[model samples]
Every structure is written in C-alpha cells, then in structure tokens.
Target: MFENGIVGSLIMIAVGIVVGFFAGFLYRKKIGESKIGSAELEAGRIIERATADSEAKKKELLLEAKEESIRTKNEYEKEFKERRNELQRSEKRLIQKEESLDKKMDSLERKEEQLQRKVDAVEKQKEELAQKIAEQKDILEQLSGLTREQAKDHLLESVKDEIKVETALLIKDMEAKAKLEADKKAIDILSGAIQRCAVDHVTESTVSVVSLPNDEMKGRIIGREGRNIRTLESLTGIDLIIDDTPEAVILSGFDAMRREVARIALEKLIVDGRIHPARIEEMVEKARKEVEVMIREDGEAATFETGVHGLHPELIRLLGKMKFRTSYGQNVLKHSIEVAHLSGLIAGELGADITLAKRAGLLHDIGKSVDHDIEGTHVSIGTALCKKYRESDIIINAVEAHHGDVEPTNIISVIVQVADAISAARPGARRETLESYIKRLHKLEDIADKYKGVEKSFAIQAGRELRVVIIPEEVDDASLTILAREISKNIEEELEYPGQIKVNLIRETRAIEYAK
Candidate 1:
C-alpha cells in the first residue's frame, strides 16, 4: 500500500506542475495579442495625421499663388493708368500748338491784305495827280491869259470860302440835332427812373416829448430844487424842458441819441415812482444800454430791409447812429433807405449792377452818423469808413462821390449820386425854415440875373425853375439857348439846392409901330 501511495503522490505532483505550466503559457499569449492591437491603432492614427498635414500644405501653396497673381494684376493696372495720363497730356499740348499756329497764319493773312490795299491806294493817288497836272497844263495853254499859279490861288480861295460856309451850317445843324436828342433821351430816362421809384419821407424833430402820469410827477422829477432833473441832464447830456404843457416834458439836445436816452430814462423813472438821484442814475444807465441795443437792432433792420449784408459790426453800429440823425428835418435813415430803393430801381432800368448800387446807396450817408463827432465832411468820413471795413473800391468811390466831392469812377457810383439827389430833392423830403427858403429863392434869381443880356429873372415853382427875359438886341435867337445853358451850369456849380433847376431864356423881339 505504501508503495502505491508514494507513486500516487508523485503523480499528483506531476499533474499540478502541468496545469501551472499551461496557465503561464496562456497568460503570456494574451499579453502579446494586446500589444499587437495597440500598435495597429497607433499606426492608423499616424497615417491620418500625415494625410491631413499634406492636404493643409497644398492649400497654403495655392493661396500664396492666388495672392501673387492679384498683386501682379494691380501693378499692371497702375502702370496702364499712368501711361494713359501721359498720353492724354501730350495730346492736349499738341492740340494747343496747332491752334496757336492757325491763329498766327490768320493774322499774317490779314496783315498782307491790309498792306496790299495801302499800296493800291498810293498808286491810284499818284495816277490821279499826274492826270490833274496834265489837264491843268492844257487849260493854261488853251487860255494863254492866266498863269497856273494865279488860277490855283483863285481855286483855293473859293474852296476855303465854301468850306467855311459849309462847316458853319453843319455845326449848327449838328448842335440842334444833338441837343434835341439828348434832351429827349434824358427826359425819358429821368422820368422813367422817377416813376419807378417811390418811397415815403419821414421828418424827425430834435426834441422828444415824454408824457408824464400827472402834474405832481413833475415836482418829483424836479426833485427839491431840480437836483434830480440836473442829475439826469448831466448824465444824459440833454436839457429837460419842463413847461406848463399839460403833463408833457420836452427833451432837447443837439445829440439826438442823448435826448433819446434822457427821454427813456425819465419815462422809466416816472413809471417806477422813484425820483431820487441814486435811482435816476441807475435808470439812466439802464436806459442807455437799452438805447444801444435799440440802435443795433435798427441797424440790423435797415440792412434786412435793404437786402444789404456783410457789413462790418462797426459799420452796422455806425449806421444805427443815423437813426436819430436828421438832414434838414428829414430822417437820415429813412433818406438812406429811400436812396437805396431809388438806386436799385434806376440800376435795374439802366442795366447797371443793382447790388453794388444798393450797397453804396445804403452806406452813402453813413458818414453823417459820425460827422458831428469827427472833423471832416461826411463824404470823407464815409470813404474812410468804407476803407476800414474793406469795402470794394466801387463802393468807396460811390460814398465819396455822392456829394460831388469826387468824380465817380463806376456806373454804380453815378447811380448812387443820382439816387441821393433824388431822395433829398423830392417834395416834402426835407423841411427848411421860412428864412432859409426865402434866401435860397433869392439866391437862385440872383444867380440867373448875374448873367449878361438878362432883362429880368424870376424864380418860379419854389425855386425849381428860373425864367429869364433877355433883351433881343443883346442876345440873338440862337444865343438864347447858349445863355440858358450857361445859367444852368453856373447854378449847379455855385448853389446848393434840392432837385434840378430849369433855366429858361426867352428872347422876343418887339417891333411896336404905333398906328397913326
């Protein structure tokens, strides 16, 4: 039995050894298979990566080639444009040269024609001279009585006499015709200009009237021995005239602006019921500022109404100063506006520059705005103002020449002058005292009477017309026209009158044979 047990144990040991060996071999085979599967997956992934890289590199190369092609195309296009421009410039230069050559050729042809005509005329004159000499010699020979020199002298004397007579008659006819045409045309143009332009005239007084609330307010205004009134006058530079004119006070001053300031200040004081000097001063200052604003506003309004723009700020303010200014009791601002309208109308009718005419007309009297403060005539001052404001040369000339102080250089300047005259000389445009009017009429008559061959002179139609009766023996019928023109010219040069004056010369020969 023991021998059998040992043999079985040995068998068992051997069986265990075999199973262990087989398990070890299967484990080794499974590990080897797993490593092979991982190697295959890594190889597939590497191949995919390499294919994607190759496709990306090919696309990058194609994009680079497209960009290079675009750059080359742009360069070629730019070069083509430059070349085309150069060609065009060359073509233009060649065309201009051709035109110049053509013009020169035409000029040469005209000169040649002129020279040929002159040469032909000289030859014809020589032929006529030779023929005349031959005929004179034959006549001298046939007559055998008079010398050639004597005959020539007789012919010259007769020709001279005929020429003198013919010249006198021609001059007379020309003068008559020219005078008739000029007078008719002038009348037509002036009448048309006057008929087209019409504006209202405004009269301004130096004194301003301010209405008070009651009579008692006057005492407050006077303020304890006129302290308040004196304070106002001193500040505003105007005289306060307090009279028994029923709750109204008169403000008088040569400076219209000052008078206006006083009027405003006084009205404000009365309204506030504060009559002390301190309150008066405050009110005056406020009133002055208000007047300044009003002046600027008036200037702007004038420009707007006249359609004139681009005036300097200083020029506009100066124009406002004319609002309170007066010329022979005519409101200067109104007069300026009327002149502007008249100038524009006349310019339109005459086909002149309307804008320039209106601008000059509006500013023509701007010098009057500062004439009282300045030491020169309004024309000179206005010319200076126009220069300071950089106005055009034409405008400066018009302003300076409107009063005939300077000769007008442009048609617009003439239009401005005519408009100023028309505006100032129109009926009711200005007012004068009875004394001045009488003196002006007497001066007009006196001017006419100063001329020779004047029997009597009468200033008729408010000094707008002058009638002179000349002695027929002293002035002939033809001389009447000359005498009238001379008198008219003398009046224009010597006198200062509104509108144009007519000088009429009447020469009537009276042969009174008394019936027996």
Candidate 2:
C-alpha cells in the first residue's frame, strides 16, 4: 500500500507540474498576444500618420500648382488685355489718319475748282480789254481829223516825247524817296559791313597751263610719233596745246577739274623726267585720283573752317566745286568768303543773327558753278538747290530774292542783294559792249525826235535830256498840251531807262517887219 501511495503522489505532483507549466505557457501566450496586439495598433498608427502626411503634402502641392496656374492665367489675361488695348488704339489712330487724308484731298479738290474758275474769269477780262482798246481807237479817230492809223502814230510819238521828261522826273522822285528810306538803311548796313571787313579780290583762270623746262622736254613728252600727247589727251579730257610759246603749254578743257588733272600730271611727269605714252596715261589717272582726294579734303576743310556742321556729304562735294569756279573776273570762293565776312559784320552791327547771315551769304552764289548747265538764274537755281538740301526757309528765301526772283522777306535777303550788287558793280567787274552803249544813247535821243511841230531835237546832258524846239507858227500854245500828252505816253511803251530823261519843249516867236 505504501509503494502504491508513493507512485500516486508522484503522479499527482507530475500532473500538477504539467498543469502549472501549461498555465504558465498559457499566461505567456496571452501576454505575448496582448503585446502583439499593442504593437499591431502602434504599427497601424504609424501607417495612418505616414498616410496623413502624404495626403497633406499632396494637398499642399495641388494648392501650390493651382495657385501657380492662377498666377499664369492672370498674367496671360493681363497681357491679352494690354494687347487688346494697343490694337484698339492703333485702329483708332489709323481711322483718324484716314479721315485727315480724306479732308486734305477734299480741300485740294475745292482749291483746284476755284483756281479753274478764276482762270476763266481772267480770260474773259483780257477779251474785254481788247474790245475796249478797239472802241477807244474808233472814238479817237472821230475826234482827230487824221485817220485812225495816222492819229495813233502821231499821238504815240508825241506822247513818247512828253513822257520821256516826266518819267525821268518821276523816277528821280521815286529814287529820292527810296534813297531816303530803304536805300539809306541798306547803305548804312552794307557800308558798315564793307568798311569793317576789308577783303582782297582774287583773279582766277579757267585754263590750267603748265610751263615745261624747255622745248626739248616737249619732244620727250610727245614721244615717238606723238603717242604721249595722244595718250594724255585721251586719258584727261583736257587738250594739250603744244604751241610755239617757249616752255608754255596750254591745258584747255570745259571741265576745270580735268584741266587741273592734266596740269598736275604734266608737272609730275616733267619733274620725274620720264615722258612716254604709258607713263603719261598712268600719271594722268594718278593725278585724277589725287585731285578727287584734294576736292574731298577741300570740302572737309571748308566745313571745318566755317564752323557749320551737319552738312550733307553731297552738299559738301558741291561746295568743293566752287573751289575752281570764277565769276566776273573774280575767284568765286574768295568772293564767297568776302561776302560771308561782310555779312557777318553787317549782322553784328545790325543786331541780327550773324552765323545764319554769314552762312546764307557764303552759300548764296553756290549755284553759279553749275548754272551753265541749269535752266534758271543763279539765284533761282541756288534757292532750288537749298530747298533740295533741306536748308532753312530763311536761307532759301534769301538766296531766291538776292536777284529779285522773289520778294525779299527777311533782313538777310536785303543783305544778300546789297552784297551781290556791291560785288558786281565793283571796278573792273563787268564789261559791256560798245554797240549796246551806243544803241542806248541813240534810242534815248530818237524817243523825243518824233514829236510833231518840234523844229529841232537835241539830246543834251549826256543824253539825259530831250530838248525840243517848237515853231510858234506850226505849234500854238494850246497845242503844246496835246503834244506833251502824246510824247509822254510813247515813252512809257518803248523805253527802259533806269532813272529818267527830261523833255523840254521850247516855243518862241519873233517878228521884225520894219527892218526888212
């Protein structure tokens, strides 16, 4: 029984130990399950947080993109609005320009129609004048005993004689009046300028003649069979005239520049002592280039000297042409310089714009260089050129009115006119033909001789006066009135006297019956 009880106790203990072990294992499994649950919950929280952060970041990114898109859209809308406004403004301006153009066209058309009507009116007036002249002739024929033709001739001749004297006096009076005012002021300005600025006149020649060393040099220049001379003449448009004048050769050409080219080339060839056809041609071409350089340089120098900037290059080149031009036996460039100086002085004295006046005066006669080829007078040509070069209106008007092409509108215009006259009227400036002078005197005398009842006509006072002696038998005191009228009318139609001519009609009668 004891052995049985021991075995049973051991069984119970083993069973109990197994039970405890199972309990402990069960407890451990529960705790581990709880810890696992807690860890799983924590893991879920971490995943949720990471998901929330991702969502937040995505939302932020989406908002930022949306904002950027809005900003870009705003910028595009603003740009589009600005462009629309600009387009609208441009369209409005274009409409306004079109309207202005249309108005201008209408005005021009209206002016043209008015001018046409005026022209027609003027034509009708001219016809009316002709008819009146015919009616007057018929009436005068009926009054006079002579035929219409004869009366017309006699009346014209008599009127011419009377008009000669009265016209002279009238001219003198007008001149005196002009001298008292306009001329006096002009003289004061011009004299003050001229007195202050003293300039020397220079003589210029058209031909550029070169002197050779000797007659022997001519043969070398001519080369064998005159080849050198031919080459030179062909290359340079100047004619090389090898005359009997020892050591003197004349270079003749219409172009002053070409003549200068020939002169300079010939001089170089002479100095080099190598005279041949090839050498002549090469030298001529070289000289041409050199002369062109000189021309451009001269233009640049003149612009620099004058202190007048912003001249067109073409205008400067044209100014260079004046370097070789001459007028009335005076160097044109020198004359221009003198005029500029004088004008400046006048401007100083008169409180006018000196620089502007001097510039205009210097360039006033620039057209004369090319006037030979141009159709208009020098003043007109120059004015047109100034207009072409876009010169000031004042300068253009001054140039035009220098020779009375248009009326003087400014003080500079008057200054230019006076200066031109002064330069032209200077001693040895111009030469007149003897035939013209003699014809003028005869014309002056013949004007008074055609009067009726005039016994004799004498042109006295250096052909200034027409003294007519009328016989008392032929011409009575009352008839002198008609004679004077006839003579005066004729002078107006035929003569172009500057000042005047006096017509004196002397009528005297004497009777001596007892002595006879």
Candidate 3:
C-alpha cells in the first residue's frame, strides 16, 4: 500500500509540476505583452511631445525673427531720419555760409572800387594843388618884386601874427566857457552832496560844569586846607575851580579825559560826603577806571555806529581818546563820525570805494589824539601811527593829504579831504576867537586885493568866501578864471585856515551908450 501510494503521489507531483510550469510560462508571456504595450504607449507619447515641442520652437523662432526684423527696420528708419535731418542742417549751413561769403565778397569789391576812386581823386587833387601853389608863387613874386623865399617868409610872419591873435582869443573864449561849465557843475555836485548829507554841527568845549546840590558841596569838594582839591587835581590832571557863583563847580583841563575824570571824582566825593585826601584819591582812581571803561565803550560805539571794523586794539583806544579831544571847540569824535558819513555818501555818489573812503575819513584825524604829547604835526603823527598799524597805503595817503600836506594818491584820498572840509567848514561847525576871526577875514580880503585886476575885495561868509570885483578892461572873462585860481592858490599856500576858501572873481563890462 505504501509503494502504490508513492507511485500515485509521484505521478500527481509530476502532473502538478507540468501544470505549474505552464502557468509560469503563461504569466511570463502576459507580463511581456503588458510591458511591450506600456513601452509602445510611452514611445508614442514621447514622439507627440517632441513634435509639439518642435512646432512651438518653430513658432517662437518665427516670432523672434519678426521682432528682430521690426527692430532692425525701426533702427534703420530712425538712422535714416537722423541722417536726413543732419544733411538738411548741413545743407542750410552751407547755404547760409555761401550767402555770407557772397555778401562779404560784394562788400570787399565795393570797398576796393571806393578805394580806387579815392586814390584817383587824391592824385587829381595833388596835381591841382601843385598847379595852384606854382601859380600863387609866381603871382606873389610878380607883385612883391622879391624872391619866393622872402615873400613866403613875409606872408608866414603876417599869418603867424594873425593866427596867434586869433588863437589867443579863441582859447580865451573856450577857456571861459569851460570854466563856467566846470564851476557850475562842481557847484551843483558839491551843493547836492552837502544838501543830501544834512548833518548837524556840534561844538563842544573843554570845560565841564558839574552842578552841586548846594553851595556847601563846593566847600566839601575843596576839602580842608584844599588838600582834597590838590589830591584830586594831581590824580586826575585837572583844575577844580570852585567859584562863588551858585552851586556849581567847574572842571577845567586841556585834556578832555582828565577833565572828565576830575568831574566824575568831584561829583562822587560830593555825594559820598567824604572830603578827605584819601577819599579824594580813591574817588579819582575809581573815576579814572570808569573813564577808561567809558573811553573803550565810546570807541566801540563809534566804530559800531560807523559800521567800521577790523581796527587794532590800540587804534580803537586812540579813537576813543578822540571822544574827549576837541578841535576849535568842535568834538573830534563827532567831527570824525560826520566826516565818515559824508565821505561814504560822496563816495557813493562819485562811484568810489565807500569802505576805504569811510575808513580814511574816520582815521584822518587820528594823529590829533597824540599830537599834544608828540612833537609833530597831526598829519605826520597820523602817518606814523597808520604806518605803525600797517594800514593800507591809500589810508596813509588819505591821512597825510587831508590837510593838503601831501599830494593825494587816489580818489579816496580826495574824497576824504572833501568830506573833512565839509565837516569842519560847515556853518557853526567850529568856533574861533573874535580877534583871530577878524584877522582871518582881513587876511583873505588882503590876499584877494593884492591881485592886479581886483577892483574891490570883500570877505564874506565868515572868511569862508572871498569875493573880488575885477576891472573888466584889465581882466577878461578868461583872465577872471585865472585870477580866481591864482588867489585860491595863494591862499592855500600862505594862509592857514580851518576849511577851504572860495575865491570868487567877478568881471562886468559896462557899455555906457546913452539913449541919445
């Protein structure tokens, strides 16, 4: 039974094997078919995709080519248009240049023709002039019965005399006319400038009066045995005059700074009621310091008001000293300021350098600040100071020339001189002693009278003007100007006056042909 079962099992196993082998073959074949189908579909899809891609690439290439073609066409058109415009412009320029050349050629031709004609005319005129000269020489020789040279010499002498007389008269007439015009113009300009300035004149005295509360205050200021007054005077360099005239004490000094210090010190002493020498000294010291501070402030104020800057510290201090200084009873500082303003105004009108004019005018009198201590004229001293300060050459020149001590180098110096004269010579600008005033007037009149043609001389306007009546027969219109100029020159050379002197020459011709 085991063998039979083994045989059946073996047979069954072989059959199963055969069936399994067939099933495996069938499954392998099916898988191979499925893989082949998938590969074929994938290959078809890849071919379609490649075809679509090639079509899209062809379209993109065509679009790019079209755009490139359009761009090239546009660039070509733009270049062509630009070239066309450039060619048109060049053609127009060529046309204009050709027209200009033609016009210039015609002008040159016309000028050449005109020159040729002028040359021909000149040749003809030369021949005619030679003939006329020869005929005139023959006629003159026949009429005079002398040689050509002698007759020519005699004619030349007569013509020369006649020319001299005629030229003299002509020159006199022209000179008179010119002088009148120049004098009128000068008067207009100066008067206009003065009128525009319109500055007030201020005159200050060296003496200052300090009012006391009562008469007893004067005695207190004098102190016991006059020790206090002596101390005050010695310290401040001022004289204290306590006169028995009301409740006032007079502080007198040549130096304005000293007088101011003394005045302030006395006022303080009177107020403090301390009438001792020690107290007086203390008050004087304080007053000196106060005055020094005031001087600095005044100097700064002057510079500020004048709009001047960049001055050295020493120069500013010296300018401050001018506050106390007086010239002919006129405040030096005020005069300087007035001069500076007037100079700027005149400079503006005359179109000169305003800054330089103002600076020169303000510092023109700076030498006066130290003139009292220095042994020299103010101009020399001022020049030295300006040189020491390293001022500009023009500034130094202005300082030296303001008083006519030296010739002015530039217009600014002249402007400063004029402004200074205007400031000092204006009405009521300065005061003089009665005797000196009379002497100046007489001197001016005498100077004018010394001239040859002067009939009568009159000094008017407080010696500022000298009017001279001249004989018309002796002094012609031209000689009148010369006489006035000579008189002015003499006054400038001989006399020492504060301001300019105006010399007026009057010439009147009277024709006494009565109505008979």
Candidate 4:
C-alpha cells in the first residue's frame, strides 16, 4: 500500500512541474510577440519618415537641378548671342577687306601697267646701249694691237707690279716699327728680369766619385767575392766601379737619386766600419730614410722660398725629388727655382697673376722627378700629376703649355713658357753632345737652304741666329720680307729649338767687272 502511495506522489509532482514550465513558456512567447509587434510599428514609422525625407530631398534636388539648367541655358544663350554678334562683325570686316583689296588690286594693276611700259622702254635703251658698246669694242680692238684679254692682262700685270712694290714698302715700314718697339720693350723687360736674378749653374755629371781613406778600403767595399758590392748594387740600382783610381770609387747610374743613395750608404758603411751584407742593408735603409727626410725638407724649403703655399703634400714631395734631377746637365731644382723667380719678375712687369705664375713655374718640371719611372714627356706627366692632385685648370695649362707642346690658354701659361725658355736657353746652363750640336746647326742651315733664292745659310752665334744669303738677281728687295717670313715659318714648323732663333736675311747685289 505504501509503494502505491509513493508512486502516486511522484506522478503528482511530475504533473505539477510540467504545468509550471508550460505556463512560463506561454507567458514569454506572448511577451515576445507583443515586443515584435511594437518593433514592427516603430520600423514602419521610421521607414515612412525616411521616405518623406527622401521625397522632399528629391524635390529640392530636382528644383536645384532645374534652376542650374536654366542658369546654364541663359549662359549658353548669352554666349550664342556674343558669338553671333562676333560672326556678324567678322562678316562686316571681311566685306570691308574685300572692298579694300579690290581698290588695292585696281591700283596695283595700273602700277603694273606703268611698270611694264617703263620696262619696255628700258629694254629698248639697253639694246641700243649694247649695240653702241659692241661698236666701240670693235673699234678699240682694231685700234689696239693686242686682243681684249691681252690688254686686260697687261694692265692687271702693271697694276700688280706697282701694288707689290707698295705693299712691300708698307710691310717693311710696319715690321721695322713693330720690331723696334717690340725689341726695345722685350729687352727692357727681359734685361730687368735677368739682372735681378742670378743663380749658380753647373753641368752635373751622372757619375759620382766617392773618396776612400786608402786602397785597402776599396777591397773592403768590394767584399769577399764581391758580395757586399753586389748587395749594394742590387739594393740601390747603381753600378759600383772600383778601378785603378788611387783613393776613389765611382758610383755610376743614369738615375741620380739612386746614385746619391748608394753614395750615402756606402759612406755610412765606410764610416761605421761595417762591411757585411747585413750592415750594408741597414746602412742603405737608413740612407734611404735620410734622403726621404731631406727630400721633404727641401720641398718645404722650396715652397717657403717661393711663397707658393697650399701645394698638395705629394706635390711638395715631388718638388723635393727635383733636387736630384737634371736636364741637359743643369740642376733641375735650381732651374725650377730660377724659373720661378724669372716668372715672377716677368709677371710683375706684365701685370699678370704673379703668384700663379711663380707657382706654375716652380712646378712646371715636377715630372722630371719621376720621368724615368713614368712614360711620356715631362710636360704630359706634369700635367697629369697636377690634374690628379686637384690643381687649378690654369696651373695645369701652364704646365702643359710650358714646352710649346700645346697652345697656352692664359697669360700665366705664356709667362711660364717664357720663363722656361729663358732658363733653359741661358748660355752655359745646358750642354749637348758634340754630334747633336753639330747636327742641329746643320739642320738649321739645311732648313734655310730648302727655300728658293737662298744662296747660303750659316748658323752662327751657337745656332741662335741663322744668317741667310739670297741671290740678288733671283730675289729682289721687294720679296725679301715674304722670303724671310716663309723661312722663319719653316724653321718654326721643322725645328725643335731651345729658344728663339733670329732669321737674318741678306740680299746683296754686286757689280764686278774684270778688265784684262
């Protein structure tokens, strides 16, 4: 009975729980439906408001668009009216132009008719004049013995002969005056410059003779089996000559710099009393360093002396290297210094840039320092070096044109050129082999002899002046100027001379009658 009562209780609880759940779900569903219905109503109101706003906006936009269209249409009409008025004005101008053109055409037609009548009259006059000229020519040709062309040629020849004499005289007078003034001024300037400067010059030798204490020291220098001498030679690139000289040894080399180093190192080795290979090497290294120091110091001294500042360090070193350099036996460093002084003097007189001139003058032959190691002429090498060192264009040009290898672009370049010539051409400053000197003199004479009417040519004054003899019968006085100029030009084009060569042209007319 208890089991049946419990089962009834469970069934009653289950029924009650189901009824409560159903009641809550039905209440929520009704509430949700009412909320949805209100939301729908709100949505409908919002859509109606939006639709009303859109309709008003559409009317405003349409009204604005219509107003804009009307405004544009009025503008278009105004433009069209303006265009039509402009077209009417253009048509009126065209009609006026047509009337004016018709009037001009009528006037031009009358003028053309008058011009044609005048042209016909001139044509008749020309034909009559031509007939008269023909008759006159026939009569003149008959009167004269020569034809027209022959007479014209004779007249022209006479006039040409007279003109040639006058031209020759004029050229002579002009050249005389010019040369007189030019020579006077040049002598003054050059004399002044040359007078103010003087430096010791010598014909430097390629070989250096280092004296020794005695004959025994020579063997010491030669070393055991010539090892010491060989080491020095290999290191310094100089040849060692130990001969029958009583107390001297000679160091020979084309490179003065290496020869100098070898001499210093050899002297040091001698003084230190160390003759082994190791000691020789040590001395050589020390000597090299010493020479380098001297080079730098000399470079600095040169810059200070010349007052040329701001040279690249490498350029300074190069200037120092010139101390060991020589050209035609003249000490190159001294030459450069002399050239610098001369350039400054000349520049001062000419009112050129003195500083630039001096600077270029000093650095003009910087290439000689390393010309052996480098190819090309000194001028070319110097130009390349200056350019590489960021030197000014004027400086490079001065160096490049110093040797007449190129045309000078400025006054400084010309000044440098002049100074270089003056320095190089100084008597006793340079020398050449006997064969070359003779060959040059002969070549100069030969160049003068190549021209016509040249009886003889003598290169005198050490080949500085060429005296040319002209056959008086062949070359008249009137033609001497042209012949001299031609010969000078030929010499200039043909010869590579140190300095200026004076061309002295002499024409002699001699009457020699022998009575037997």
The CA lDDT of each predicted structure is 0.87, 0.79, 0.86, 0.90
Off by over 4 Å in 2: 1-204, 253-255, 426-516
Total clashes for model 1: 0
Q: Estimate each model's TM-score.
A: 0.45, 0.45, 0.45, 0.46
Q: Which residue runs does candidate 3 get wrong by more than 4 Å? A: 1-204, 426-516
lDDT of 3: 0.86
Candidate ranking (lDDT, best to worst): 4, 1, 3, 2
Better of 1 and 4 by lDDT: 4
Q: Single out the weakest 10-residue window by summed lDDT for candidate 1.
A: 197-206
> What is the lDDT for 135 in model 4?
92
Poorest 10 consecutive residues of model 3 by lDDT? Answer: 197-206
Screening candidate 4 with a backbone cut-off below 3 angstroms (N, C-alpha, C), the clashing residue pairs are none
Write the residue-wise lDDT of candidate 3 on 370-483 in tens digits: 898999998999999999999999999999998777889899999998888888975553546789889888988898888787899999987878888988887666455556
